[model samples]
Target: MIADSEIELHASRLMVMQAAWKHERGEDIRHESSICKVFVAEAVNRIIDRAVQMCGALGVSADTPLEHFYREARAFRIYDGPSEVHRMVIARDVLRSGNRS
Candidate 1:
């Protein structure tokens, strides 16, 4: 699970980098940014959840920062446009472009 989460994190980072590159070139990155927001938000939540699970009860305790991290990660999914909304944006863009790939 940890290995899978690491791969997901790396993939999310690459997506953000690609979006940043497009932005640097003065191209509109609305679609790319939406993808990044949804992916990275989920990736972070998954990674943090794994950490909390590994730490067992201590992970939820106030003695560590895991709880705080988990809470923030959960909020990340909702604040920057919910994942469902972003997914709809992505789907609409793809359908409008007629690009299945």
Candidate 2:
């Protein structure tokens, strides 16, 4: 889980960078932005969940900020737009572009 989370974190960072690059080039980045948002939100939640699992009960205790972080991370999925909605946006874009194999 930890390894997967780390890999996803790097991938998500790259996705954001690519989206930002597109935006800088005066390209419409709505699709890329939605993809980045969804990917990063899910990645953050997964990473925080793994941290909580690894720490066991201590993860939720006030002794650590894991619980607080977990709640905030979860809220990320709903901020701006929910993951499901962003997913719909991505799917619509892909289908409209006929980008599937």
Candidate 3:
């Protein structure tokens, strides 16, 4: 779970950097940020869920920090951008790229 979350975090940072670079190169980045944030949040949430499940009841007990982690993970999904919004950005980007051919 840690590995998955780390990978997601790295991917998100890379996407953000790519968007900024594209903006600097005169390409539109309005969608990239939205997509990146959504993907990252989703990935992290999944990872956290798995981690919580693996830890069993302790993962949710107040005696452990996992509960706090779980709460933060749930909250993150609502921030930046939601999963649906990101999916739309990705779909639009794909359609616009004309790579479907």
Candidate 4:
């Protein structure tokens, strides 16, 4: 599970980097960046949640490092523009694109 989560995290980072590279080249990638950040944050949150749950009550208790991990997992949803905001951005982008075709 750890290995799989690590792979997912890495993939998300790669996607964000790729989108940034395209933006640097003058591509209209505002939506891409938003989507990438949302996905990456959500993925990392899921991984951290799993790690915490696997540790049992220690996950939320202040006696263990899992508590800190749990805090970070909960924060990820709000730190990067929030999941709902990103979803809205993606939907708007898709709708605008469709109208142009």
- Candidate with top lDDT is 1
TM-score of 4: 0.78
Q: Show model 1 residue runs off by greater than 4 Å.
A: none
In lDDT terms, how accurate is model 3? Answer: 0.76
Kindly list the per-residue Cα lDDT of model 2 for residues 1-92, writing each as its tens digit: 78888899899989999989989999999999898899899999999999999999999898999999998899999989999999998998
Model 1 Cα lDDT, one tens digit per residue, 11-80: 9989999999999999989999999999999999999999999889999999899999999889889997
| Candidate numbers sorted by lDDT from highest down | 1, 2, 4, 3
For candidate 3, list the clashing residue pairs, or say none: none
Pairs with steric clashes in candidate 4: none
TM-scores for all candidates? 0.94, 0.93, 0.68, 0.78
TM-score (C-alpha, index-matched) for candidate 1: 0.94
lDDT per residue (tens digit) for residues 1-101 in model 3: 67776787788788778888988999867777777677767777787787788889987889878788778878776766667767787788789987722
A best-first ranking of the candidates according to their TM-score comes to: 1, 2, 4, 3
What is the clash count of model 1? 0
Model 3 lowest lDDT segment of ten: 76-85
After best superposition, candidate 3 residue 61: deviation in angstroms? 0.8
- How many pairs in model 2 have backbone atoms within 3 A of each other, for residues 3 or more apart or on separate chains, i.e. clashes? 0
lDDT of 2: 0.91
